[model samples]
Target: MVMSANERLFYHVLIRILFVAVIAGSLISLLAEQFWVAELFTHFRLYYLLLQALLVLIFLHTGRHTLMALTILFAMPNAWVAGPYLIPVYGGQRATAKAATSIDIVALNVNYRNDGFARVAGYLRERDPDIIVIAEYTPAWRDELEFLRKSHPYQFGEVRPDPWGLAVFSRLPFMESELIDLADTDTVHARFVFAAGMMSLEVFAVHLLPPKSAVWARNRNLQLENLVDQLGASTHQRIVIGDLNLTPFSPYFSRFIERTGLQDARRVDGFHVTWPVSVFPVWIPIDHALADPEVNITSVHAGPDVGSDHFPLEIRVSKGVNKQPGQVRAVFE
Candidate 1:
């Protein structure tokens, strides 16, 4: 079939505009480190890729090979950013030592306004991860999670009314715990230490402030930088997990991972978008777990949407922690 001259012109114009938009959007992501607005643009890497892909197909259909080639060329960077997360490691090699133990951790936002206590509680009972870290924790959530006390005997955390509140319940025993509050940044985060044989392991859990404005963005970046020091002396194998409110595409995120040397869970798990599920066609991964180079991300599973705008993340981390041989710990209600 042959297109009319008018139709050809219209398609060409539309494709050109989209190609330009994609290029601008991609460039803005590069300035994420310097500008908060540019940082926001970094979150939707997949969206940019999709838009460029659509343009490429349209240009090809219209027989505009030059524009298609240019679109494809620009789309490569976006593809590189989103590709690793799209394809997860199905079954990576693991440590075969007899003492190696892997534990499943459930990280949930548990929105403050949501009153679906039973729904969230039921999912916790069903999934039954060895460790459950609750963000956006409230006073009301305290009683609701009591049932878990039996299985996860060693519990630690703070109950607050704000979104930054957090709590952790774990079946494994904790050797130490800290509520890190940086004086300058006014950011509070939870850190728990556990023993795995002679090796000490640290789990840093947090729900950083969302970059809603310039002030919040400034604090968020400060909090991210401060966390490196707040995490302290690197004497333990670290596992940093929770709702960072910043996506992997952001330059700050890349720098944090580089400076901290923690591996992102997404590299092991497929592209898991956990936020803004309430909205259609607009979602990016803000929740994440980054572990030390020696630690292993066995698997990660998405929990059912139990009333929070963000879904839950069930992650299995192994090869660093230790467990007794067939000796089970007692449960207390």
Candidate 2:
């Protein structure tokens, strides 16, 4: 088979256009994350890596060395951002022996409409976490979760029909529990001062708005900023968990950690994808557990899907230091 000069020219032009488009899009995605409009794309940073990989294969087959080189170069930024997540370097020093005291937490977003209550209840029974946090908790879920009261007598937060509804159940008694509204979102903050031997811990269960639109994105950022402010002001060792609705790769997520000085448990553990469980490769880790520097994350992993779009996050933490005098208690309203 032979191609005329016109056909050759057309093919060359088409390839050039594609090369330029890939380069331009890649550049924009890498730089635009700082801007509100472009920040939404940061959620798909993993997908961008896949796209760049496919483009590399195409360029290789077409013998477009220059385009391949440029694509590889532009892809580095995304790779840099995603490397820590894909790699397991963050897992801290292995504990020679288990700590004397520990706390287990299970965080999940029970889909407001998913009726797989039995599955969720069974999973909770199997895990037997000390603290259980549920997002998108509706009136129906409250009824389904009533059995938990037998084990977790101390409950906080309210169940509502809206997706923002949040709840926390603790087997340990709470010294103080406060429900604060930030940027129109209700957040639950609690302090658990255990008996003589156990360490006092602070916990927060938050459900930020999804960034479906620019306005929503801004609001979510605002909520996160306010939450960080609250976290910064706190003196107790903290464990913050819930459906943050943002991936670890997002600029805002990075900012949240930087500002609050919380360590993401996922970094120490493997990158466990927890959203859109029905989908195979298109999943993202929107649920997270961020712990303060004083808390030791012994283990963090994802739980089985229980008829919800998001999977559960289970984290085991222990005190990093000996018990200290309690901080001034915050009013629980």
Candidate 3:
């Protein structure tokens, strides 16, 4: 039986829409390396699911070949709705400042492609964060960061002679600094000390490798799990910050939170976007700051873009009295 022209055209358009949506959603996941599509579709997951359901009509009329293709296409977006959708909604909570004694820290991944080092440097200097973690650093960035020595006199992490570099700077002194290589080609990890009275808080700055493949994704989660376990065992109050390359929506991210007992600063209120700064006003929070329970997070904010693919993340956190030296207990129970 030959189909009518109007019906054929309708099915064609429907298939095209489904195909485009799937690609767009997958691209968002790939480029952002975070659960970006989930956040983007948070408010519309149900609507999208319904739309996909309606696509069945187009599928049934178009024949089995088109039906299978449309089915696969629609499944991509809905796949994100699985475990990830639960996270940005329930995992990453934005914390509010409650009292005085809280310290502040900021984590940002100033996209390596950016050349506005001075602007990024200036922004940090103005914010005057107690601690700052930067990923995707380059040797060229070193000169621009010299100004930071004035305030955050203490710093660590080498200038990656290569393209992908990671570093940390802080007003607080350090007990030790080491690079953590998770079999990745980049040197993107750093650890340092944040001292106050009888206690010293250890911080690890990590930028996981881009999770483009299933193996890489699993390894990224494993590396993070190892890092979390190490920190959780330590007696000092700890904080993990940087571009984890995974979002709350990912199973790895949830495992890290559950394993490390850390809290996402944005989970309480709403998600923040940090990539493709040029697309201003329409951003999703890819950068993050996760802290152990001992660290009292005051507030977290998205700062202005500095000619980078990612926007800076600003946060204020304080040390709780329970974080004292004698109060050495397992960080995550």
Best by lDDT: 1
Which lDDT tens digits does candidate 1 get at residues 188-240? 57889886545777988988889999999988888888887755565677888
Q: In what order do the candidates fall by lDDT, top score first?
A: 1, 2, 3
TM-score (all chains, Cα) for each model: 0.86, 0.81, 0.68
lDDT-wise, the better of 1 and 3 is: 1
Among these predictions, the greatest TM-score belongs to 1
Q: All candidates' lDDT scores?
A: 0.78, 0.75, 0.64
lDDT of 3 by residue, 1-333 (tens): 898999989977877787567545544543333553343433233344445555655556657566657565755655564434345555455556434466667777776667887788778877777777777777777777777778887787766755458878777777766777754544568877667555677777877765666666657666776686678666676777777776565545656676666767554334566665774454445577776655655566677876677778777665554343222234356
**Which regions of candidate 3 fall more than 4 Å away from where they truly are?**
1-100, 183-186, 196-199, 280-283, 321-333
Worst 10 residues of 1 by lDDT: 324-333
Give the Cα-based TM-score of candidate 1 against the true structure. 0.86
> Candidate 3: how large is its RMSD?
7.6
Ranking by TM-score: 1, 2, 3
